[model samples]
Target: MDETEELIALCARALVAQMGDVPGVEMALTRNGVLGLTGAPSPDFNRLTLGAGPQAEDFLISSVGRARARGLPLVVVMSPQAQAALAPVAAGLGLTVAGTSPLMVLRPETPVTPSRPVKITRALGVELVAIAGDLEAAAFDEPRDAIARYFDVCLTETAGVEAWIAWDGDLPISAVTVTPTGDTAGISLMATPPEHQRKGWGRALLTQVMADYRSRGVARFHLGSTEAGLRLYESVGFVTVANLSAWLLPAEGALPGRDRGGPS
Candidate 1:
């Protein structure tokens, strides 16, 4: 409703467009392998949908019904107006709702202006490897070949949100992506393997991710995070700047997948 909220909404819409076209885990198709307009084909569980829209209203109702009927956690994000309209629809279907409003965390030009006390330094071996279609592995139960081919279709259609694998050894444990938003970077789909978490994998990965972007003169960092991630980002020098939350959860509800690192 305010200026900041408007900015968040704009950023989220941009990300949805970017991620939806990619049709990766976060933007996967359903289990039935239904041919989405994108033709990338994801599991029904990994549906990529628009926020509540006039054209998408009936489709959202159907999605909410499907989620309730199947007991799967169906995720939908949209504008505030669309969210409000879908409220009754969600409630009508007995679906639990939550929303992790998107927020912008700005980095000051002079982050090191005033020197602090002893800085907490840790040994973090971080590298940003750019791959055209690195890890398109099946997020659900599909075979690797099928998922990769499907993802390739999405990658071809998308102009933003290229994949980046964060690796420690030969194996990639953590992964996150950035979708271009004009001059800004909208970070999305961050994940770490279950066995690899709590070892600062996410922290280290995010640190390097931002550092890489900053070096390129990327101004504002845009992202939508769960509540748990708020604290994590704050520790990494991110400030609460805007709200792009949808009706995925309650206003005070926790963000999703703060604990589960890999492939949500």
Candidate 2:
């Protein structure tokens, strides 16, 4: 694979690891795709990542079958090229197009310096996990329990993932996660409560995380960006490298919710 392809695959693996350890969740790599099964209400957690190739269509078909068998909503992550190749097959399977997200990367020649002195602390213990989960849920307008599950999974593990919360005078305002894959670190779950937006807390949190990872000898960073935060990430030296599309298959008698905002 080329550098871009390698980076994308690395990011995908990182995400899989982040989703690991959740109760009733399982992940497997097959010739078809990278499959994640979460027999829960969160559709975002149940995903399939498809690569571009002649087998892409077959992979999509099998992935859909796997999701259907589990009776969960299916989110398919595919490169733009792969999406094009499998569009007909996806459509034939009744998969609805769920918007596209840009995959961005940052390769810094020097360690990133924080824009301001933000009191960022590593999230430890169950209490802090609940706080971080609340911050995330408030920021994304999601259910607290759902966001808490993510924190519960990541914080319980030492390898592959790390979580941090930005505090303003002991008041947690933002949260971030870094998952390392090979030489690249994937950033996700970045969220600042609505009351804290436009005040630079998000940037400060991200800067600190970048600096922390850089100190660990990680130079490359990858994230999936939404339109709202694209400019903020660009200000910090991130650039769009590729696009990722998600095709959704909702469970019977259920409608898929709109994609959540912020970096994934």
lDDT of residue 168 for candidate 2: 93
TM-score of 2: 0.89
TM-score of 1: 0.55
Please tell me which predicted candidate would have the highest TM-score against the true structure. 2
Models 1 onward score TM values of 0.55, 0.89
Superposed Cα RMSD, model 1: 9.9
Worst window of 10 by summed lDDT in candidate 2: 255-264
- Give candidate 2 misplaced runs (Cα > 4 Å): 253-264
For model 1, the stretches where C-alpha displacement exceeds 4 angstroms are 1-5, 12-74, 78-86, 89-95, 99-104, 107-158, 241-264
Clash number by candidate, in order: 20, 0
lDDT of 2 at 38: 64
- Model 1, range 27-119, lDDT digits (tens) per residue? 223221111222222232234234433544566655544433333344455445555666677566544545546564655452411122212
Q: Model 1 scores what on Cα lDDT?
A: 0.47
What are the lDDT figures for the candidates, one per model? Answer: 0.47, 0.77
